[model samples]
Each structure stands twice: as C-alpha cells, then as structure tokens.
Target chain A: MLTFKVKRRIIYLGIFCFTLFLCFFYVIKTLNQSLLYFKTPSEIFDDQNLDLSKEIRLGGMVKKNSIKVNKREIQFIITDLKKEILVSYKGTVPNLFLEEKGVIAEGKLKDKKFFIANRVLAKHDENYKPPSENQLDKK
Target chain B: MMRNLFSLNKIYIFSEKTLTFIKSVFPVLLILGLTFALVLSPPDYLQGDVVRIMYVHVPSAWIALGTFSTLTVLSIINFIFKIKILEIVNLCIAPIGLLFTCLAIITGSIWAEPTWGTWWAWDARLTSMIVLMFFYVMIIYSQKHIKPKNRSLMFTSIISIIGAINIPIIKYSVEWWNTLHQPASIKITGETSIHSSMLMPLMLMLLILLLYSALIFLMKYKTEIIKVKRSGVKRL
Candidate 1:
C-alpha cells in the first residue's frame, strides 16, 4: 500500500494529464481546418465548394517542360503528380524556382484550371550535397 | 530521503563546482564549433555558403524546443510535489528558452529570404513557432510581475502546463500541413537525409550551445540559492 501523500500526488498527476488530453481533443476539433497552411492542386480539384474569391496558396512541384516565360509575366504548371494547375505570375521567382522543384504560389484562382499568383516561393528538400565537378565548373 | 538528496544546499555546492568546470571548457569548444561550421563544412550544391546558417539556426531551434519541454515537465512535477528546487530551476530556464526561441525566429527569417524569396509567411510551422515565443513571454511576464509568491508560482505552473500543448504542434506542424518549411532531415530513428560532413558541424554546434545553456543555468541557480538564504528561508 502506498502512502496517502503519494496517492494524492498520483491523483493530481492523473487529473493534469486528463485535462491536457481534453485540451488536445478540443484544439484538434476546432483548429483542424484553419491549420492547413496551403492546399495542393489535387486538393483544389477534389473540392468543389472551396472559396474562389479569397486569396489562397497553391503548392506543388513545377511540372517538367511546362514553363513559359514572357517579358513581364511567367507561366508554369504546378502539379502534385495526380493533378495539375496552371500558375501565372508577374513577380520575380525565387532562386530555387526550377523545373521539377517544389514551389508554392500565393493568389486567387482564375478558374478550376488557372491560378493568378502574386507571390511565388521555392521549397527545397532536406537533402544537402556539394555541387558535382561539372556543375561547379558551370558556375 | 529524496528531499534530502536534492536539498538547496547540496545543489548550490554542486553548481559552484560545475560552473568552474564549464567556464574553462566553453570557450575552447565554441572556437572548435565555429571552425567546423564555417571552414570544414561543405557548401550546399544549390544554396552554396548560405547553408552555413543551419549550424546556428537548427541548434537554437532544438534547444528552444528542448528547454520548453523540460520546463513543462518540471512545472508539472513542482505543481504536484511543491518542490522548491524545481521552482528555482524553472525560473532559471524560462529566460534561456525565450532567448533561443527569438534567435531561431530571426535566423530562420534570414535563411528564408534568399532561398524562399520571402522573409516571412503565415505558414503553419512559422506561425506555431511565433505562438511558442508568445507563450514564453507570457510565462516570463507572470513570473516577474505577479504578487504574493505562492500565487505567482501557481500562475506560472498553470501557464507552463497549458503552453505544453503547443510543443507537439510545433514539432509536427511541417509534417501535418502544406507549409513552406520542409520536413525534418534528421530523425531519431531510421535513416537521416543530411550528409555526414554537414552533420558533424551541426552536432558540434549543438554541443557548444548545450554547454552554454548549462553554464547560464548553473549561475542563475547559484544566485537563486543565495537569494533564498538571504531571505531567511529555514526550510532548506
């Protein structure tokens, strides 16, 4: 048998943990929808009731050989491998914006197929490696 | 028996000895860490030398997260047991965690600009980190400004326990959301994506920061002990 004080402490701990669990449950229930920072092309296509007027973020890889550059605007296809959306932007892109690389475009949708982006950000993978000899020579 | 083993007098004496040892070792390790991070580590194939920021950025983030987790655990224990030493430990740790959290945010902004083309974003990971900083500020503010010592302790402990909810949210934010921040490269289990060459300097920097935190914690703990004694606290 445990002492009374130890038993009381255990009761306190149990109460504390249960309160924490309740808080976690409440946050998950209420904040789940707002917590998604961006939506992918596939998600946009799958959802028909998404608001079109509000500014939203579209994130995916820049599809290979889908880039079209003009003097003032640039256009490219953003894809999640299952679906694709055309993104048009007038602002300058980040240094990491390249074909077959991850990119996030922030703007509103023109339709189900095209997005008008006011900002573009490049997303790189976690892997870090030094430039190979030929790539270094190109620089 | 447990109380006697962790009595304030014993902790004070232990801190004095440890502080001297830490003071001697910190500068040497800091120099070695800087050399390895700046000169020895290879530049990234894509970002080049800008990748060096990870040495400072990643460790600060890790320390900030680790300190908050520790504070939350200790706060919970102190709340249940009313341990005086644990109170002092929490007091010393909150400020250090705040400093590192700020450092991580600033360094992350600097890293974000060149690579991501933006200095800030409302992404889940970044937003969650900002929320953590606010929680730290709230805890520190309550500790400093609240009246009636017992009431202050209760408030701080409650805030810390509530703030503990954000810790898991911050860690898993990148994975759970479509955020600009990439997922973790280093894992406790399974294979790590980061190369060994860069990993060495990162580990060294982590060691240096850990030592620095230890040094600060010991000093703060010693001062708190002295303050308690001067106030004629006979419980010790």
Candidate 2:
C-alpha cells in the first residue's frame, strides 16, 4: 500500500511537471516566432544557445560616437564594457534611443557580430543608484 | 481510529464510505463547472466578454496566495505547536500552491499581453508574482538538497513568511503607485463597477472556479493524506 501511494504521488508529480513543461515551451516558442529573445553581444559571441532563424534582441549601452545614419538605415555600436556589437536598424526608432544609453534592438544577426534590428526598446528604469558610502560603512 | 469517530455524521451516514463521498461530490462539481461553461458568460462591459477569464484568473490568484498562506501558517504551527498533522498539511499545501501559482501566472500572462500591450510589466503585482514563482521553483528544487527530516520545514517556513509580506504590497500597489494594470473592477462598494448583465456569468464562472479549486484542493489533499499514511506505516 505504501508503495502504491508513493508510486501515485510520483506519477502525479510527473504528470504535473510534464504539463507545465509543455505549456511553458508552447508559450515561449510562440512568443519566439512572433517576438524576439533579448540577448547581449557577449552572450552571442561567447557561443550561447540561441535560435538563429528566429528574431532576437541585442541589448547594451550604445558606444560613444559609433552612430551612423544613411536615409532609412541607421548603424550604431553597442558596448558591454569588454566587447561591442555593430547594430543596424531599418525602421522607425524609439524616441529615447540614442548614444551612451541602454538600448534593446530586436532583429537577427547578419555577419558574425552585426545585428539588424526590426524594433527597438529604450530603457525605462533609470533611477538606479548605489547606496551611499555612509550607509555601506554602517553595514 | 480517529476516522471512526467522525464517520457518524448527521445527514450522510452511509456505511459504504469512501466511494460514496467521492461519487456524490464529483458530480456536483462537474455540474457546477459545466453549467457555467454552457452559459458562455456574457462579455464584461468594460473589458467586454474577455473579462470572463477573470473567473479563472481571480480564483487561481486567490487559491495561489491562499494555499501559500495556508502552507506558511501550517509550517509555523508544525514548528511551534509541534502538531504532526500541521506538518503534513504544510507539505501538502506547498506543491498545491505551486500549481495554483503556475495557473495564476499563465492565465494572467495570456490576459495581460492582449489588453496591456505586453506579456509582462514591472508593476508591483506582476513583479511580485514573478518573484513568487521564482521562490516557488527554488523551494521545490531545493527540497532535494535538504535533509528529508523536519529541518527543511524550518527554513522553508521562514522563506514562505518572508515572501508573504509582499502579498499586501501587491494588493495595494495599484492604488499607491502609477501602474498600467487597472484597479479592481469589482469592489465592496456595491456601486456595480461592472454592468449587471455581465455580473451573472462572471459570478457563475467565479462559482465554477471556486468549485473547481475546491475539487482540486480535495483531490490533492486526499492524495497527500494517503502519502502520509503510507510513510507512517513504513516507519512503523
């Protein structure tokens, strides 16, 4: 009887997990096809698991003086301190999108490091501040 | 032995016990759930009919938090009162809360992207729900790392209580802060924030969800009882 009960619990747990697993993937993959997974430049070049065909987002702070625009196409560089990615966009840009600010560019890669953006999202949560030195000293 | 004393109830005193209770309750819940499903529940006036999803959303949210709260208190009871039943109750509620939390997040997410223009926002409710989900998964996963004895319950209860402080924050955050999430459409004021026509199906669906939640709650609790009984027998 104990064996039967343990077996039942294990089976139920397995069933619940399997269902959630399926639902999670169904939602993610559907979102993946429609939208894009935001990834950093270093995450891509460092050889992470990412779908190449589907859309993706390249996010980082815009490197200083790395912006170039010619008619419909705009090119810029995104830096994550150690490395950077050349990003180009072919559509309307977000209002707050510009140099030295954190930007998330949605598209796919073209060359080894070049990103073609279809949509862009500007960073909104910018009130980040470190606790004062006095607070740290108290701790 | 404790089961015998409670068996002599007022109304349903059939000796053919376990099967009898299951048979009776099962159809009632099924009928209640089925009737609401049939009504097709008229659309909410403001949200239109899409708000019928609230039927599922609210109960899941309710049960999700309710189950977690139950778990926390039972865990505390197990520690303080040293009640063995409370410990089992705490264990049983953990995964049940996780299940409802999963349901709540998914239903909320599906409803969110359509109306809110995005699947998720960093509003207090959504943020806390994400953190709750993370904590749920972490607690469940960390169960393996913990000793099988009651030592894990102490730490788990602490985590549960700490996470619970956020529930009130989530409830009031919409009022306190600027948020994309709309405030509660239904309220205690009785001014009928939603149209009367929509209220019927909405209430119906709410009933269905409550019944469904109770049904699942009983099912999970029953199975948990069996497990505890089995484990006790093993130790014997």
Candidate 3:
C-alpha cells in the first residue's frame, strides 16, 4: 500500500510538470504572433525586403516643416534620427499631431522610403492642459 | 479530520483602537482623494477629460498586483512551513484582490475606448492582466468548492505559487513585446515621464486606494475568523 501511494503521487507530479510546460509554451507562441504591432523607422530601414502587402505601424517623430496639407492628402516625414520615412495619409489627423512631435501611422509600406497610412496617431506628452477660456468661467 | 483545522474560540481578534483608527481615517482620506482626482486635477492636453480615468484605473492595477504579490509570499510560506495563520491570510486576500482586478479591467476597457480607438486589444500587457484575474477567480473557486479543508488549502497554496510567475510577465509585457499599450511612464530609476502637477493627485489617489484595501482586508479577516469559530463550535 505504501509503494502504491508513492507511485500515485509521482504520477500526479509528472502531470503537473507537463501542464506547466504546456501553458508556458502556449503563451510564448502567442506572444511571438503579436511582435509586429509596431516598428521604428530604423527597423524598417535595416530590413532589405520589406513586406508591402501586410499593413504595419511606423512610429517616429514628425520632421519640422515636413507636413504638407494638400486638398485631399496629407504628407509628412517620420524620422528616428538615423533614417526618415515619408508617410502619406488620406484622412484627418489627431489634434496632437504637431510638427516635430512624436507620431505613429498605421498603414502599409509603399516602398523602402515611403509609407501609405490608413490612420495617423499623435502621441501626446504627459502634461495636462489647464482649463480653457470657457471652462474658466464655470469656476 | 481536515474539516476541524480551525477550532472554536482561538481566532485572532483586532483591538478596538485599531478598528476605530481605520473607521475614522479612511473616509476622510477617500473624500479628499476623490475630490482632487475628479475636480482639482487638470485634464490632459491630448486625452482631455478622459484622462481622469487614470486616477482610478492605474491605482487599481497597482493594488491588484500588490495584493497578488502578498498572496504569493504568504502562500509560499504556507507551503513550506504549513502555518495556519498564513492560510487564513491567503483566503482573506483573494476576494479583495479579485475585486481590484475586476475594477482595473473594467476601467481600463472604458479608458481604452476613448484613447485607443478600440475597447479591447490582444496587447501583451492586457492579456497577461486578464490571466492574473483568472488566477484570482480560480483561487476563490477552489477554496469555496473543494472538499475537505486541508486538501483545499494545499491546492490553493500550490495554485498561488504557480500564478506568481505571471506577475512579472504582466509588468514587463510592454517592454518585451511590441504592443498597443504604452510603456510604463514611472520608472524605478527616479525619473517620471509625467509632470509634477498631475503626479501629485495621482499619488494621493493611489495612497487612498491602498488604505481602503487594507481596511477591507482587515474587516474580512475578522469576519472569516468569526465564521470559522462559529462553524467549529456548532459541529461540536
């Protein structure tokens, strides 16, 4: 009876080990799938054969005076100091998307140096804005 | 045999002064913290009024993680030393931790809708936080439903040890993998990405929420002890 009880406990321990191993493996595999959410200009610049069919996000700072508002299309350059990629979007940009500020555009690569953006996100700094003119009157 | 692990009339009880201190101080702190977080603080330049959600959302995440860490430590000791008090502590902390985890997920969902253009994402940090919450639910369920008190406690302690590994994964998920969730603004290197004006109220809200959780834990602990004592006596 004692030997039988010991054998059962060992089996339980083995099962526990197998389950833990499988859970960790599953998490890591899923994590690898999510690795393409964003890429910097330097990363894309280093890659020789970039995927144009798959949509990707290009994140960097907007170069000063690089923003040009055309009738339907808006064009700007995103730079990471080492390299620059021009992003063109056909949609309205966020309010915080200012020149020389941080921004991330979601779209596909047009070429090695140009990106066609589906959406433009303006990354805001951490500071809070004080109440504006109309908001001050209520106080 | 395991059903009688805790006998009647031997549970720890808090002193009157301690109860009074928690009762009187926590409400004042809560009101002051809420007023500052909701009204006095300035809105974000980009996020505007929606940024106010951070006061509640961020602190809940912090407290949830903190509670889980405490549970992990207590469970480890319980596993090694088999201390009875530590088992009770583990049971008491689980529900409070679950409450905070739920609050963090719900408030985060609300905040994300305005800021991220979507209510949910498979972001690494978000997914791992949800996993932590599931662990909390598992702990609570096993404790409540598992038969034979000693076996249930042992199972819970082991489960907690297994779940402790996920806490670090949740903390560093943003850095390890590229995701939509932003990287942590506050760093242990003494540099904060946020300005002082916004930091002050946020810190206050976090402090009050911690105090509130502590108070709830103490009250729940007392009630759990009382329940055990009553049940044990009735079986006698």
Question: Highest TM-score: which candidate?
Answer: 1
lDDT of 3 at B34: 84
- Evaluate model 3: give its TM-score: 0.80
Provide fnat values for all models in the order shown: 0.76, 0.00, 0.23
Error (Å) of candidate 2 at residue A12 is 37
Instruction: Write model 1 residue lDDT over A28-132, tens digit each, in one string.
Output: 779887877778898999897978899999999999999999998999999999999999999789999999889999999988899999999999888876667
Residue-level lDDT tens digits of model 3 in B1-236: 43355442333434245667878988888888889889988887567788889889888999999999999888765655556878788888899899999999999988876666556766678888999999999999989999899889878877886888788888888778766677777777867866566788889999888877777777877887777678778787
First chain TM-score in every candidate?
Answer: 0.89, 0.61, 0.68
Q: Name the lDDT of candidate 1.
A: 0.90
Worst 10 residues of 3 chain A by lDDT: A125-134
Model 1's TM-score against the true structure? 0.94
Q: What's the lDDT of the predicted structure labeled candidate 3?
A: 0.79
Going through the candidates in order, what is chain B's TM-score? 0.97, 0.77, 0.90
Q: What CA RMSD would candidate 1 show? A: 2.6
Model 3 Cα lDDT, one tens digit per residue, A9-105: 5566557657876897687778575554578899998888777899888888899999999899999999988899999999877666788777878
Q: Show model 3 residue runs off by greater than 4 Å.
A: A1-33, A122-139, B1-12, B15-17, B234-236
Candidate 2 runs further than 4 Å off: A1-139, B1-40, B142-145, B188-192, B231-236
User: What is the C-alpha lDDT profile of model 2 across B1-236, one tens digit per residue?
Assistant: 64554332311233235435655776776566545644544543223344556667766777777776776666544444455556555654567678878888898877765443356655556766777777676666554367876667656765765566556655655555434455556656755555454455556655555555555555555665666567778788
DockQ of each: 0.65, 0.02, 0.25
